[model samples]
Target: MLMEELPPEAMLDGPPPDADHLLQRTLGTVREERHQAVLRRGRITAITSTFMVAGVLAGGVWLGHGPLVGGTDDEGEVLQGTSSAGANMAVKVTETEGGLRLVATVHGVPDGAACWLVVHTKDGRSFTAGSWRAHAGEVTLAGSAMVRAGDVAGVSVVDHDRRPLVTAG
Candidate 1:
């Protein structure tokens, strides 16, 4: 007698061994490659960003420290302050209609007192600009210092003995 074929009901209890686990593994490799690519891009971006920041800082420092035409550093400005260096004197050197001129003014004088304008040149010459015997409770003088490049003109308030009370810078 021929062997009777098993009924289809016998196969209904289980699935076939046809699942593609190899395909899942290949997909996992693809995902890992994609993740590595993203990491590489991020590293490159960070390096480039660091370089850009350093460049900006260096440029700023150079411009601030480098000397340029018509540019004066802090030291130069301090030396130029108040027009001269002497007693608490303040002078203004300007070019007026007559040419280079200097004007000196002093205030806070004693009531009913007087003051004089003293002018000195770097060339060992001294002259008096003008004198005022306390007018309007203030003393002021106008004088010109010899104009020389890099030269300073000083104006100072003088007392009875020609002693500088407050020298103009």
Candidate 2:
């Protein structure tokens, strides 16, 4: 009955030596530890790669659709005017980091005519924002000036001779 409980190999020579048993158990433990280490390393690599991809995608989105120069509200204020020569003008002013940015568009201007844009403040201050040649159908011009926010009160379009052609609030 006792011999039936023992394996055929263990039945030989009163069983295997303790050294062989210890060596086999130790090798099994080492293999298990090695497998666990490999799994831990794989998990760490996967997590790091996921975070790196997410960071790159976030940065791309920020650079693509981020805020403009002065933050929101690209179109600040639009001023409409009609010149004595029947030309219609529109000017838009928006805030910027340093000062202000102005855009002027004029329609029905005579060809070869020089025109300028003037920005006026509430404190009776004026500045020539920009100038351009007036076209027959339309003329567009842009400029920038250093001024505080909410300081501008009006805008004016002038002819080549510095004559005020149109004014608007």
Candidate 3:
């Protein structure tokens, strides 16, 4: 009879066939390649996401409008005030066509207390930027001074008695 006419059991009555081994090897290779491809795609996706987040943060900083990154100070310097009497303050000095632009923030100051901004220069000169009474909460003050660049040594927040409530540089 022909090989095709043999019974199903007769077909496996010898040593394990070479065809089965080859098929198994081929299947294993295919599975491994598929797994590797999946891993590669995952890694690529992770890297791409990280880059996207970094780009967004950089853009926000460049725009000069984000938490911890406000008002452009490219042409000036930023000074942080030391907390005194339970109040915190910060100052930013920016150069303008007329002179210097001063921006100040005071927080936790005593309510209704008179507070003044003092700008001290490195050349033994001092100028009062502005003054205001603190509110129940935080307060922001702005002013301008006709001072030269690189001359400002520090800034101070003083009470009505001229006692420095907080100083910063």
Q: Which prediction has the highest lDDT against the true structure?
A: 3
lDDT of 2 by residue, 1-169 (tens): 8878987787577545797888899999999999999999999999999999999999998764435465675657788888677878888777776777777887876777787888889999888888887766777788877876599888888787877877777
Model 1 lDDT at residue 96: 31
Residue pairs in candidate 3 whose N, alpha carbon or C atoms collide under 3 angstroms: none
In the range 59-132, model 1's lDDT, one tens digit per residue, is 99976444422433322211112223232444555533232344555555554555676665567555666677
Q: What is the C-alpha lDDT of each candidate?
A: 0.55, 0.80, 0.81
lDDT of 2: 0.80
Among all windows of ten consecutive residues in candidate 3, which has the lowest summed lDDT?
64-73
Candidates ranked, most accurate by TM-score first? 2, 3, 1
TM for candidate 2 is 0.55
Q: Where in model 2 is the C-alpha error above 4 Å?
A: 1-70, 73-75
**Better structure of 2 and 3 per TM-score:** 2
Residue-wise C-alpha lDDT for candidate 3, range 1-169, written one tens digit per residue: 5988988988676766697898899999999999999999999999999999999989987654322223345646779876746778888888765567889988877788888898889987889999998888878899767786578888888899988888888
User: Candidate 1 has what TM-score?
Assistant: 0.38
- Rank candidates, lDDT, best first: 3, 2, 1
TM-scores of the candidates in the order shown: 0.38, 0.55, 0.54
Model 2 CA lDDT for position 87: 75
